[model samples]
Target: MPFIDLKTQYKALQPKIQRRINQVLEHGQYIMGPEVKELEEKLAAYTGAKYCITVASGTEALLISLMALGIKTGDEIITTPFTFVATAEVIVLLGAIPVFVDVEPDTGNIDAKLIEAAITPRTKAIMPVSLYGQPADMDEINAIAARHGNIPVIEDAAQSFGAEYKGKKSCNLSTIGCTSFFPSKPLGCYGDGGAIFTNDDAIALACKEIRVHGQSQRYVHTRIGVGGRMDTLQCAIVLAKLDRFDHEVEQRLLIGQRYNKILGEAGVTTIVQRSDRTSIFGQYTVRVQDRTNLQKYLNECGVPTAVHYPVPLDEQPAYRDLCKAGHTPASKKIAGEVMSLPMSPDLTIDDQDKICAALLAGIKQ
Candidate 1:
């Protein structure tokens, strides 16, 4: 089975997708066209945020957020190590130090208890990645940020577009939230796309300008920025996808809970979900010993699997010298054990059962 059943999703939405594409093609305003603003407005309304700024990709979203906040050389940004490298890459790209904290053993989210101690006078921002489609302890993280001089908290929500935390959407739960449309994500487009969400008008305005080479108006360069505008075509595709996004999110929630219940009953170690929040299951992952052997067995059983992350950022060769790795044992250990199962809104119950059976058999073997 396909790890992410995008083909089936495409089949379901083919007509809408075709119509949207045709509109874009006919308009011929491929760059920053009408579809771009339409998507930004729809996303803003969906997330309950005052503004949504679409960008070329998730990585660009993060970079632009940092730039808007004026995060510069020697400024420290606290984050979790157990995530995609793009989380830390943005920090380092702007010449900032990425101070990593360990993650919770159960949810694989950054440990908020350790975050406060990491903050200091030089701390410019706090970035918490919403791993596996569940939001990090954003309320607690925001609280900590508030206690310590109201540090800007950027939620790296690349995998959590439709997730919710404490009745709030993932992308609207922080100072600035960024999410991706990287084909395999919960809400994806045909190609690269991302957006930033924020209630802060000043930051929102700065991001809007920074997204297109810091131009306040056409040809008026107000500050340093990058050409990070998401193409109108991709926006059109996302708008098409958005037609059924809420329903898809519901499907993903049910499917993820099904995995948790089934795997837990079989005595498998599943990722824990908190009561106050909802996950979109961008990847329905679990922790297991002997992961390499288990992956091999599942592959042989025709079950495709993946690892969300295999190495903590601090332990990586490129970043080892930047931060001490002594205190991030949870991230280190989880890296060796976490393995993702096939997940998507269109994933069938029969396929889920087969995947679980294969996993149980592999674990017992």
Candidate 2:
């Protein structure tokens, strides 16, 4: 079975996707076509955000959001060390420091309690990544940000476009929410794409300018920026896929619930989803002993498995000296034990059963 089953999704929406592509080809406005604005509007309405700005990629979205917030060199951005490198890479790219924080062992999300302690006078923002399709505690994070001079909060919602937390969508829960459409994400396009969402009008306008070489208008360079415009064709592809996005989210929830129920009964430690939150099951991850051995056994049994992260960002060679010494125990332990099973909206129950059986056998070995 395929890991994400993107082919199946494509087959399901072939007609719509073909039609959208045909329209884009006829228009021939590849850079920023009418479909780009159309998709942005739909995403803003769906995410309950006043403005949405599409960009070249998720990294660009994060960088643009930081720029819009006026985060400067030597500023500190508090975030978890247990997420994808992009979470911290953006800070370093802008010559800002990423103050590492530990994550919860159960949810693999940033520990909100540890955030405030990491804040210093130089702290300009708090970036929390919504790992494995589950949102971080935005309410708590936002409260901390508010208490500390209203520091900007950027939610890295790359893995959690369809996720919900405390009655709000993941991308709409913070000061600036950034999500990716990197083909494998919950809501993805045909190529690299991302979006930044916010209710603040000024920040939204700044992001629009920052996305296009900091131009307020043609040939009017307003601020330092990058070429970060999302292609119109990619935007069109996302628009086509939007038709079945709600249905895909429901299927992902059902598959995740089923996996949790079966794996729990079989003595597997599934990722915990809080009562006030919903996961999109981007990875269907679990913590298991002897992860390397289990992975080999599953491979032998025709079941594919992978690791979301093999090392904490603090432990990575590039940023080891920058992180706090002797912290991130949970992140380290989870890195060694966590494994992700095959998961997708089209994943069949029979396939899941086979995967579970293989996992149980691997543990026995």
Candidate 3:
């Protein structure tokens, strides 16, 4: 079976996808086309954010948000070490310091309880990732940021586009939120695409300007920026996918819950999603003591498995010197154990059953 069944999803949305692509083709305004603006508007309204700036990719979305906030050399941005490297990469790319905080053992998300201690006079922002489609404690994080002279908080919602924390959407849960459309995300397009959502008008305006080579007007460079606009074709594809995104999110939640129940009864340890938040099950990860052996066993049994992350960023060679010395026991422990099973909206119950059975058999050996 496929790890992420994009084929199945594409088959289902084929007609709408074709129509949208055709519209974009006919218009022939590939860059900054009408579809781009339309997608930005729809996504902003969907997330209840005042603005959504479409960017080239999720990484670009984070970079652009930091640029908008004027992150610079020596600026400290506190974030979790237990996520995709892109989470910390953006911070370091701008000559900023990535203060690696540990994550919660259960959810594998940034530990908001540990953030305040890491904050200093040089700290510019707090960037917490919504790992495995589950949002971290944004309310608590925001409260801490508020206490610290209202520092900006950025939610790296790369794996949590359609997720919810309380009644609010993931991408609108903090000062600024960024999400990806890397063809495997909860609501992805065919190619690289992403958006930054915010209620702050000034930040929103800055992001919009930064997305297009910092052009305040045609050929008018107002600020240093990257070529980070998501093209009209990609936007069109995402707009088509939006037709059934809500229903897809529900399906993903149901599938994730079923996986949790089945795996738990079979004595497997899975990541825990909190009651106040809904995870889109971006990877449907599980924790295992002997991950390497279990992965090999599963492979032998024809069950594909992958690790979300094997090394914490703080331990990475390049980041080690850049980060402050601290004992992040939880991040280190979780990094060695987390493994992801195949997950997609179209993943069948039968396939899941086989996978769980394989996992159980693998664990026994």
- Tens-digit per-residue lDDT, 1-365, candidate 3: 88889898888999999999999899899999999989999999999999999999999999999999999999999998999999889998999999988889999999888998998999999999999999999999999999999999999999998999998999999999999999989999889999999999999989999988898998999988889999899999999999989889988999999999999998888999999989999889999988998988888888888898999999999899887666688999999999999999898999999998999888888
Please, what are the lDDT tens digits per residue for candidate 1 over residues 1-365? Answer: 99999999999999999999999999899999999999999999999999999999999999999999999999999999999999999999999999999999999999999998888799999999999999999999999999999999999999999999999999999999999999999999988999999999999999999999999999999989999999999999999999989999999999999998999998988889999999989999999999999999999999999998999999899999876344999999999999999999999999999999999999888
Indicate the TM-score of model 3.
0.99
Ordered from best to worst lDDT, the candidate numbers read 1, 3, 2
Instruction: Tell me which of candidates 2 and 3 scores higher on lDDT.
Output: 3
lDDT of 1 at 109: 97
Top of the candidates by lDDT: 1
User: In model 1, where do residues sit more than 4 Å from their true spots?
Assistant: 324-326
- TM-scores of the models, in the order given: 0.99, 0.98, 0.99
- Counting clashing residue pairs in each candidate, in order, gives 0, 0, 0
lDDT of 1 at 360: 94
Local accuracy by lDDT, each model: 0.94, 0.92, 0.93
RMSD of each: 0.8, 0.9, 0.9
lDDT of each residue in 1-365, candidate 2, tens digit only:
78779999999999999999999999899999999999999999999999999999998999999989888788898998888999888898888888989999999999998888888999999999999999989999999999999999999999999999988888999999999999999999988999999999999999999999999999999998999999999999999999999999999999999999988998889889999999998789999998888898898888889898999999899988765453789999888888999998989989989988888888888
Give the Å error, residue 215, model 1: 0.8
Q: List candidate 2 stretches off by more than 4 Å.
A: 324-326
Q: Candidate 1 — which pairs collide?
A: none
Error of 1 at 341 (Å): 0.4
